[model samples]
Target chain A: MGKRRTGTPTLEEVAAHAGVGRGTVSRVINNAAGVKESTRRTVQQAIEELGYVPNLAARSLAGRRADAVALVLTEPDWRQFAEPFFSEIVRSLGDALVDTGMQLLLTLVRSEGERQRFLEYARGGRVDGILLISVHAGDRLPDMLAEARLPTVLLGRRSGDEYVSYVDADNAGGARTAVAHLLERGRKTIATITGPLDMYAAQSRLRGYQDALALAGLRGTRSLVAEGDFTEESGRRAMAELLERHPEIDGVLAASDTTAVGALHALRAAGRRVPEDVAVIGFDDFPLAQSTKPRLTTVRQPLEEIGRAMVRLLIEEMEEPAVAWRHVILRTELVVRESS
Target chain B: MGKRRTGTPTLEEVAAHAGVGRGTVSRVINNAAGVKESTRRTVQQAIEELGYVPNLAARSLAGRRADAVALVLTEPDWRQFAEPFFSEIVRSLGDALVDTGMQLLLTLVRSEGERQRFLEYARGGRVDGILLISVHAGDRLPDMLAEARLPTVLLGRRSGDEYVSYVDADNAGGARTAVAHLLERGRKTIATITGPLDMYAAQSRLRGYQDALALAGLRGTRSLVAEGDFTEESGRRAMAELLERHPEIDGVLAASDTTAVGALHALRAAGRRVPEDVAVIGFDDFPLAQSTKPRLTTVRQPLEEIGRAMVRLLIEEMEEPAVAWRHVILRTELVVRESS
Candidate 1:
């Protein structure tokens, strides 16, 4: 089991340097009781001298590691549950973790107290690794976990300069593709339902929409852009606002499938035919897209692959803590359907 | 903290009985080393004779318990991810666990190896309690958990004779109400699309459909029944088969909203209008019910309440291991809309 570490020092080496038995070194590393204070100090000195960082997989092989990872969702809002994106990502991540023999512990930290408690639990070696999703730009969890020297991975980065390992879909690229397709279809008055601008993904998507309109020599006006929080009702209300501002809008790009469903409903109620009167598209081609009447034409983010990538990256870091941080950007494609 | 147990033996009493210090009793109960072997043996004997179950909440307050719970989903199919039911329940469960400060760990065991590994992990005292969902009749998880004496609560029962504590909705009664509503609307030829019969909930729903028809002096025929696995595709296929067998059928009761959505699609393709040529009713009035074209008139199950109830029961069992097993049956209501 220790042979996997090619360049790393073994527990036996640390024990030898500390002039203690291997079991003593193991107990000290695992923070288990029974080690004498003086002997533990010697082991710590040896570890510092050798710059020893425990190989997570090797520790598990020795039956010291917990062999569990925490998937943390910190959104306090229960309304987020209505969006199927998080659940789908969780299922995919669970499937990816199945063959790895590691259990997935899902932690939802809503308040500062809960966040601090979870951080303490993770720092105390309750879980071997952590996967954070739906993290906000202002969240300190990623930094805290990194500071604790815990092997942590993020589904999406909190900011562009994120130092933590993460995997994210090309939100901007998907939005650009949606807008470009609408332009190609000769839709003169294109509009977009943007998600809350505070979110990095939402901000990037809005940029893409703006860039696409700029390329077509059309200024993306404020009147053509309405804000939505990625819910159906928000989308409906936003669409109504957009129509009142620009009734001639012939193309729509919603930030999410639920929002698109709402846009479709509002358009239908306003007596406009989909694709004929106005072409509509959505992001995240979840099952809701297929179940819609016109069958939503949307950008399909590889959610399952994104989940698998997070697991793979986190495992790599856990196995070799000295590895550098990685940021993977997965591509998204447009799924053409009746609505577009 | 020990003062909370008014009737139960306090740690101080146990320590006195064992002729040891209170700290020694605490160390022994927490399995913290440093106590002499003889002292640990005496504390164990005193605890056994005194029938001390160790107040879990008090233990947690003292920062002794792991303060974590596991939510297990044993369904192997990824298609289950598309169901909004699981997501909503998870949200509610997460909300319920918030004030308790116990983190929720979600485990999806898909294979025999995974199941065995999870059972061992749970039995090893990794998590304080478990909340299981989507378990099948043949699954031994509930029984294994019960045998391990771990505080466990299930979302639904495995069978009629299930000994584990559970919270379930009135599936049969909801089905009967749906059918009776269809009958009141003067639908002469009513058919049913049932979920897989292996699940007790599905069986109960089919029974209710038959009972409703029987009450109106009409015998349910083989041609009027089609089975689905509670998916839209299965629902659509079942509806197609039912239509082929009984083209004159004027009413349909689907076991789930997803299935009913499929039935609506198939009916439309067959040139049949909903509630005119056929009145369709679905169970589980999720958000998808409102998104459909004509909308779905289905049975509204208190999914969030069910989640809270499961959490309440599991916490009770954890706080008092000797408490009697509880079986909570929640009520369901019919939500009328355009479909029926």
Candidate 2:
């Protein structure tokens, strides 16, 4: 508790206060597991009492890692910012990083200028690795990071031939399972509301729907498939269009739960009873799925598992830069409720 | 782009590629405003082509700022993590920091040990400032930060007499306005579902309800108040308890929109008509407020404005450390809808 001669208390002062060597205090500060529990406690107490603040910049300059990871959001649309998917993934990522002693730096790169700025920031050794989410097709940020030899992991792939490290859900397989379930329930005429075709996940989902129909020896007509942007309004519009073209449609699969909610609204407006008139299934089984009227039967993506996998891959790449890029796709489950 | 003989491309190579001086390249890399648009483009192309990455560690060691901010979440409850409030605030903060070239480092400090770890991380000079959210009353992290001389800003106060810099919405005023609105609608016996009183925001909201009733020459009875923890389940339990205690209650004020949704569910279960039998008002006009059966009337906190203010104050403090800590309180507005 003595007044420091300098501006802030040093490691030496903490060691002196605890009657230990400076190296012991350093070991404790670094959270080295080799230190004895009792000695670590005494050093921690002295450090807390003395208000010792370690200089990370100096330590990093001395060849220690920055011990931080950057979680970059590459999507520019503000509407996606409000989606439950984003928050869920972020929370899961935070949970995965809880014990790693590595902080998550959230950055939004909207334009080319901002992307360049982020590259420089990452290259400057501020972060040990990067986790990217919502990256669009043809976005060169991933390739740039790869060329720069920075360790990076992406939430989803840009294409089936994506060379960068990524963790993706079984979007196609989930959609196929939903369609198969609807088929098993004696629904003859089926329709689908797909997400935007430009994205790989959406394309994969559309493919799944087609594959399921083909496997059942049925051809999916063009009129029965409508494109949506994964928003509620888009879903409503697509659903209305499908109903208009084929009023006998007995089954519908939406690319996302939000879209499914919109579809439900449209169906209600048309006085169609859920399951009795139109069996509906949604993807991403968000919390809203359980609260909707009739309760949506949807496909639940293993989002937490995806987040953990992303972190694991990024850490591996950071620790061993020569490691090959990895692509991990986690399985999805069909959650049955009242809607189906 | 010349072939690099050593490790990665250097700044000098980028300057040579751009046909500019090293200082000019540095200026462009730092995003200095002095560079012409055309010159900036040329320098940028060179940097991109050469894949030159600046050493931020060296730059920071030479007295340059890290140009990064740390956003610390002190709340440990996983349920709260799923709330829309957290995502909205984070998006707003990201928007505010867009043009500043400052990255947001998100750190969750759940335990005292993690709090100490965060302090070391912040003090290590990885971030230029810190923004704290979901801090509970009597938490000493703020004081510890102050003693460490770190430029920090809190989303809400720890207490009424908090000395740290903070930006908060008028929770009490918002609640008062909501209660007043219910009374103006000729609600005779008003009850309230309160959030957890351990938090300052919840306490202020409860006081606001009492103040509004007292101002109207009516005493708030102890039997009319039920405690909730801002969760939908808590709201439902509290509302059911309140109805049992006072079945003749004609109006109710909920601490949050989530709580109000629960109240609405309980009223429906009891066969009570919305505006005709029991009018209800909620705080925090979340998107869910609009999707409710009766479309809840609620108080709208200026969350985006609060976020912008926090960033502004932190940047100011970072620039001028000697500036006195400022407390900012933004006004809230009531959005009238169908429920009340």
Top TM-score model: 2
Model 2 - which docking category? Answer: acceptable
Shift in Å, residue B329, candidate 2: 2.4
- Range of the 10 consecutive residues with the lowest summed lDDT in candidate 1 chain B: B55-64
Candidate 2 docks with a DockQ of 0.42
Q: After superposition, how far is residue B305 of candidate 1 from its true place, in Å?
A: 5.6
* lDDT tens per residue, model 1, B165-252: 9999999899999999999999989999998888888988999899999999989897898999998889999999999999999999
Cα error of candidate 2 at position A29, Å: 5.6
User: lDDT value for candidate 1?
Assistant: 0.85
Docking class of 1: incorrect
Query: Which candidate gets the maximum DockQ versus the true structure?
Result: 2
TM-score of chain B of 2: 0.93
Model 2, range A1-340, lDDT digits (tens) per residue?
Answer: 8854744677788999999999999999877778899999999999889878776676676664678888998877656655677777888897898789787767778778779888878888888899999888879999999987899999989999998999999999999999999999989999999987878889899999999999999999999999998888899999999999999999999999999999999999899999899999999988889999999999999888988999999888987884698899999999999999
